[model samples]
Target: MTTADVRTVLTDGDLTVVGQIVHASNATLVCDAQVGDTVVRCVYKPVRGERPLWDFPEGTLAGREVASYLISEALGWDVVPLTVLRDGPYGPGMVQRWIDTVDPAESAAERLDLVDLCPAGSVAQGWLPVLRARDLDGDQVVLVHADDPRLQRMAVLDVVLNNADRKGGHVLEGLDGNVYGVDHGICLHQHDKLRTVLWGWSGEPVDPVLLADLDKLLRRFDGGFAEELHEHITGAEVRALQRRIGALLEHPVMPHPRGDRRIPWPAF
Candidate 1:
């Protein structure tokens, strides 16, 4: 289906709960959204199920999910999947199209996980090491990720979103051969809360093409994109988003980690 078709089904279709993503921090329901003959699998996060966060306002995570999708679209990156805010079985919530990922067990040799673990000194030829630690059996292992351009784009998107919890599990290797990021409930905060596992490109020059995309996004913000974003995030947050883009345009380089706690807990 086209992006528009998927958006229409997510926004206007009837949702029926199929199961629950039990591992999620919040109540996450897997559902099938159907409109006529079209049925799309989606994950729904109702507002009532959100856990309170000390930094973010209550009942706003759903909006922030949609807001992040908007930002990704504005960047022309498609880093985020199609997501919408709508009424569901549990109430108004975030609905995101479910991604089908390549099965690691079935395609181990062909799978390209954005983040992974390797022996302490065995980082792969195309992977970059983030840190070293002991595994469950007390064996040394290194946390690493591929040095691929797709992941680099996601890293840039995380920077722009101020994504505070980009755990490795949130980065998916879609069966369709695209890298997608998920679980963005803690993003777009007014303050700098960037936290992610994709720091391999830190201090590297930003690709010129991506800088052009940021330039385009800034122009869209001036053309009323900020107002559109204000519906989901705070006005101050929107301004902060603009400021972040402006800073990137001025510096044109990927940022290095600032102080400790830059990477999220439970990195995978």
Candidate 2:
């Protein structure tokens, strides 16, 4: 894909931003559609780290914003709109669709008001942890009480993709009793990263129901997942994902790998 060049980004108080939206765990700028029927959203990174090509193949952290979106959309998750936006403020902003995370089944679990929940959010110094602990089962996301199989599928897909931000708040439940996933800007990697309270069920074997879902996902992954990932992530990263998928299918309850890699508390 050709890099998009936009020249009119804005950061006034009136346009829904009390502050800048971001994918801080990975150093990205998040924003909503400023214009368009399609309503483009995005996360952009303008810097290329030294030996930048050695790390995550999702491209520059900013570019990962797009790669993250592509991976989620391909898996059929209801990811927020993610784009490579340009206009004002920062250089390239990763634009993501504004999603309504209000499921009647569950609360949008509170974002860890803690400063270290996300590394990028930590340095950008924009996000301040909520200053209170929250119950994931609380009605902060969607407005429902039971787990939607589809949403569960998406969550499982996230683990396979190595998403590090499956905070209770990020898994939104909708009024229609549907589950919508957001904050995928830090996803799709070759790392063993997997950390979440949702894994209370981890180490427990996959039951037949979840196993069935895996069967379906395996089929889908083999079919279109490859072509779709090729668009944004590198061949090696995509191959790693394929390997990860195989591992999950064989044993669904392994301890999440990357939980230890993240800073549990702020270095600051």
Candidate 3:
């Protein structure tokens, strides 16, 4: 059966739900979930009837699945796996393997300085994010003082280039006090979908490993590997992806926004 069909069995079996569309405008079914004894989290087009799924970007879920497999193999990132199945309750939806870790919210609530997702400026190592703000549990989650001059900057440029499917909550604080990026279902897009708050290192020197990864990406793009994805992505998107790789290589020095780095509303 298609992945969509499996979600049905999951929800019907009575799983513990954790997440929901924070905005009502997004009635789409999503949950930081638990199935049987397995912790699972996923989002999908809500279905109707005894087994009806509502509207969602059809195959968008599937495409993310494809993207996850590729990046996890290349980067060893903890990309979650999802299956678009018939939600027995929510109807048609995607079922995913849940991550077992505390989120930034729980971390902050418990006064735990788990993983420092601060900006990269003058300290530490590893893939720490720069800007992390969440509205978890109706109490806005904020920990680090925004003005920490020593914190490393966020890597919004890398995120955008990756076309990451980074919902605010998908990023996690592992028990090991390290930040683990999850939910890469919508990444490595062929388009220039660079939208993130990690801009602290915008104009800084590129990390050797990150640069190496991008170079590898370019080789794959020009090779038959990218061809395998043509059926799944748009031509413009492919070009946009190439453009990002080339641009980052050429000019990896763009300053962070003068003030708030938030993308403008109604960007249409």
Which prediction has the highest lDDT against the true structure?
Answer: 1
Residue-wise lDDT of candidate 3 within 90-165, one digit each (tens)?
Answer: 5454455433575556445534242333333433433334454444345433323222221221243245335333
Q: What local lDDT does model 3 show for residue 204?
A: 71
Candidate 2: residue 247 Cα off by (Å):
1.4
Q: After superposition, how far is residue 25 of candidate 2 from its true place, in Å?
A: 5.5
Q: lDDT value for candidate 1?
A: 0.92
Q: Assess each prediction's global lDDT (C-alpha) against the native.
A: 0.92, 0.48, 0.45
Displacement of residue 207 (Cα, Å) in model 2 is: 5.8
Better of 1 and 3 by TM-score: 1
Distance (Å) between predicted and true CA of 144, model 1?
Answer: 0.5
User: What clash count does candidate 3 reach?
Assistant: 28
**Candidate RMSDs in order:** 1.2, 10.4, 8.4
Which numbered prediction scores highest in TM-score against the true structure? 1
Q: Which prediction has more favorable TM-score, 2 or 3?
A: 2
**lDDT (10s digit) by residue, model 2, range 1-268:** 1123222222221122324434244444444435332223433333432124344443445445566656555545544343433333444444444445444445336433221233222323233232233234542221121223554455576666676556655665455455656555456677665544344333555556655655665677667776766766667777877777677778776443343443212222
Candidate 3: residue 43 lDDT (0-100): 52
Q: TM-score ranking from best to worst?
A: 1, 2, 3
The Cα RMSD of model 3 versus the native structure comes to 8.4
Ranking by lDDT: 1, 2, 3
Q: Return the TM-score for each candidate structure.
A: 0.97, 0.55, 0.53
* Candidate 1 TM-score, C-alpha based: 0.97
